[model samples]
Target: MSDRTFTLDDLRRILLESAGAEEGVDLYADISDTGFEELGYESLALLEAGGRIEREFGVSLDDVNLSDITTPRALVEAVNELLSVDTAAA
Candidate 1:
């Protein structure tokens, strides 16, 4: 896999443009880390977060399990595939 880099800002843009969301709603708000955990962000919050992720990564979250995303990194990897991330691999 080729080393790729993308900023959180890129994600924010996609979230707003594609998912029609604002940064005001943050799932990783109080969490120290972004990962899937019952103790962490709730499913709804996770879904919302996933929406931003899918938008940012240009991926589809329809069939993907909610639990599949436990962290930002995992989310990126999974989404990269759907997005056809050439800068990075999923």
Candidate 2:
């Protein structure tokens, strides 16, 4: 696992790329207020994004409840919470 920390921009890029959005799509804009469904994303896209997040942040989110993560803020919060735990464990 890496020791790198992720920022909102990283998460946004990962998600947008995973979701197959066009280049330069800003997931952190007003779009963050919308759900994935509203953004035309499906479960598989989120799963891929989650995988990228794990690889990038060096944290496991396999046990996280994705159903509650409807927006970028929620995703960031979840990742931060997991990162805090990882930091504590280290």
| Top TM-score model | 2
Which pairs in model 2 have colliding backbones?
none
How much does candidate 2 score in TM-score? Answer: 0.80
lDDT of each: 0.54, 0.76
Q: Candidate 2 — worst ten consecutive residues by lDDT sum? A: 22-31
Which pairs clash inside model 1? Answer: 34-71, 35-70, 35-71, 36-70
Task: Kindly list the per-residue Cα lDDT of model 1 for residues 1-90, writing each as its tens digit.
Answer: 334344445544443454453334564353324444523345676677677765544556887786766665565556656555544553
Candidate 1 vs. true structure, TM-score = 0.47
Best by lDDT: 2
Per-residue lDDT of model 2, residues 27-85, tens digit only: 55776567777776677888899999888778888899887688777888788888877
Per-candidate count of clashing residue pairs (backbone under 3 Å): 4, 0
